[model samples]
Target chain A: MRGPYTLVHAEDNWQTDMGAWFSGERVVFRGKDLFTELNDFSWFKLLMFGITGKEFDDNQIKLFEAIWVLSTSYPEPRIWNNRVASLTGTARSTCVLATSAATAISEANIYGSQAELDAMYFLIQAKQAIDEGIELKSFVINHLKTFRRIGGFGRPIINHDERIAPLLNKAEELGLANGQYLKLALDVEKILLKERFRQILNVAGLAAALMADQKITLNEYHHYSVLAFSIGNISCYIDSSAQKEGRFFPLGCERLDYIGQEKRDW
Target chain B: MTKEKECITTNIWHEEAEADNPFAAKAAYCSGYDVYGELLGKVSWAEYIYLLFKLEKPQPWQSSLLESVAVAIANPGPRDLSVRAAMNGGVGGSTAASCLMAALAPGAGKNGGAREVYQVMRLWQQCGFELSQWQQHLANYQDEQAVEVWPASEHPPGFDPYGASCTTPVLQTLDHLTSLCPEEGALAYLSEHRQQLEKAADCPLAMTGVIAAAFTDLQMTEDQAEILFLLLRLPGAAAHALEQKKLGWRNYPFFGDGLTLTNDPGPAPKEDNLQGAL
Candidate 1:
């Protein structure tokens, strides 16, 4: 049967300012000669420059890089993205494929950087509500009712996330910790604890507060968080190189129980 | 006093209720018919899906094809990124939403998932209902080399990565399903020219290719095709996540045989790099 709509032709006029290739001479990244001018810059600085269309000072670069370093050490393959990376290695895939697969799978609701963006958004809204004479406890309760699960708080497997203290410490060391958002996050944590929730602000929450202080948009914050966790994913993939193909954990299969129909005639 | 409020404005708007009961609400109306009244038990889920998207119920063969497609791509095993992500999240004691998030993320990529399938469907459509036309277009595009039609990649979409022959079952399933349908549309064309296409591409017809062809034949939009693929895979991902949760938290290192603490502190930064960066 013929389709209802007929194909139409139009002149292609697509354009992009992100990056471009001009034959074999040199690549242009964000309107700058990548090989010539940007070669001396650090990868983090380059990434920031690419995203924000602005250059950063050494201190700023260090601060951002430190955030990445602090956040990139979750090498436990049980983390979703890390598991993808490890499985990629077991499949004997290339580093690019491994990292790509892992990164692709990192865009999750809670376990991924999206939680940071959501936390940032919520904190902003909470701050607004507080300014408008809403009680903090009531605001928290309302947020819980609306969102159900609070982003960037109450990590699994532990009552407190150890990374939060170090991250806050690092932010303090960098002289970038004295932000209202961080205070609000801490206050929210205090309220939750008072209410007997046992929820502490995790690294994502801390990062959200820091990013809010820096006036970073949710989009940029999410992207940066992904970049921060990328090394962990890549490292997990590399570490699993010693394992045989399709053997992530030897006992993983043993743990699985066949609960389906027992021996049936086809 | 009565003329003082002539410029009054109201903010709320209302639509007349269709159902007899004032408390009841109608969420969907299918093909000018009440969904609850006409479609609830009458149509299969696959047919309902098609009806919801295309505004018409699918043919028996189309619904059958969709059912088979869902069954075929449902579980790509635990090694698939979606399943692996769900399992990992489950092992970490994450909620079902987190697991589902991980499960959905990999569907956006070009590897054995919806994104690649959507692209292949578009490419098939662009080929314009003929095998020779597709071959000619490919040849011309290759010869020109001035503009890249597909994304800049070493391997094109609809082809598997090297050393991975994982799409066999998917293709076989597609073949079995298409055999039940009449010899027409994109599926028949693809099946007839499968050997040539594979020979030209230097790769077998991947699962994405078959799915693309099937979806195109069904006249589904790219977005609909992707959503269908994800919906089909959702149950499998949920199963994997629940199973992994049952297995409890995995404490062993991803690489070597060592039981690491769940809350193990991160490694100290290397002094040299720290100093350099600082």
Candidate 2:
């Protein structure tokens, strides 16, 4: 399938200051004792890059900024997952959708400085809005209750996300969104759903991704997709970790035997 | 609003408590729910019922709505939102919603985690040798102090304890696993690597390669394959991350750079090589 956006692959060592895409802007190291904190940030960056090929986008970066604010100034529990984890379906979904949408749209809109400037501006704005007390209509709720027949407030996995949309909608009104990427995202959503369903599009994942397209880089999207599915494995990891009293996946001689045996069965 | 907040918080706490059950809890599993196919393809009949009868996560009536959506999607006559949601992961909307978009696209390969195992296997095959030989060579290479390098004996360097190389359990497990592979070709590959494994025991990637190759030979579903991938890749990713974290490096210079074949460069690729079969 044709990627909705363009991917300009560059060779290693070219050292282009793709503007805000630069490492200094991308990698922020903040904590007490620069020497030790620098060590932790390097690891965190490695872990983050392994999960998502791209550097932390504006949302992640903004989250790190929050961490930095806490780290250097006040110090709090890692704020990124804190806020993200606390969010239920609609709000959480929208936050992910909106932020990922911004990154892709801004980058695709203009490469280099223009892209970086646009990305940073929108991100900084969204970060500020979240800091303020504004909340918007939950898009997940809107989609669930109205746009899609099966989505919304009553579903068991996501009961609390009803409040997210209002906050996001209010944020949109405050010019947190340029709206063009969202509009185009909707168009792509329509095309994808039409292909999936063999008719006009429904507000399904394809649509959500089209929405995500406006925010995340394709590689980032791939990471999101992988992580989403890996949620199942996360449960397994948690189970194994709990049993071991630490984070570990038990590897043993017998289990290894079972795996190898299965492979050669055919 | 206060009442609603209280209710939501109470419910969240209750759900968290109930999520403890591994077999029954719907709380542990998130639905990509389906509207047209199941609910828009977000929740499925089995899952909704699971939430109700098994998990009891929500109020019964409220949970029933999720099931109704699941049924609507799976109606089968026409592919509706319910069905689309069911079809989200695989077909008929039972698929996860996050996974739905990629599944809809033709070229977005179906295998995700299972393919990682296959990749490690492909890499192993690329560096040709029989699985048995590979196991022995690495075991000897790693635990040289523990045992003789390559006499045709039951106990080898990797078999005994006290090898400077830490992953002895991993190598032994792979050796046992290689014996189980169905194809003789794979067995032959194992035979070729026995000696080389003795020479370079320190290579974690090679050790990983042995474990990965052995695991790939087993029959597994896409989900199972994914579980294995995470299990194996975690060590490598963690090691890379750890180095950068501890060393305070600019990047994971060790990883992203191509892996070098330490033992033999192996022979020229032939038509019968496992790489061609894949």
- Clash-forming residue pairs, model 1: none
Across B175-209, the per-residue lDDT of candidate 2 in tens digits comes to: 55455454554333543554455344333332334
**How good is model 1 by TM-score?**
0.51
Across B67-132, the per-residue lDDT of candidate 1 in tens digits comes to 878787888778687888788878888767678777887765666677777767667767757667
Score candidate 2 by TM-score against the native. Answer: 0.26
DockQ of each: 0.02, 0.01
Candidate 1: residue A238 lDDT (0-100) = 86
Model 1 residue A27 lDDT score: 67
What tens digits encode model 2's per-residue C-alpha lDDT throughout A151-189? Answer: 111222332333234434433544433444344333433
Weakest ten-residue segment in model 2 chain A by summed lDDT? A257-266
Segments in model 2 whose C-alpha atoms lie over 4 Å from true places = A1-168, A189-266, B1-118, B121-185, B193-205, B221-278
Most lDDT-accurate candidate:
1
The candidate that achieves the highest DockQ relative to the unseen native structure = 1
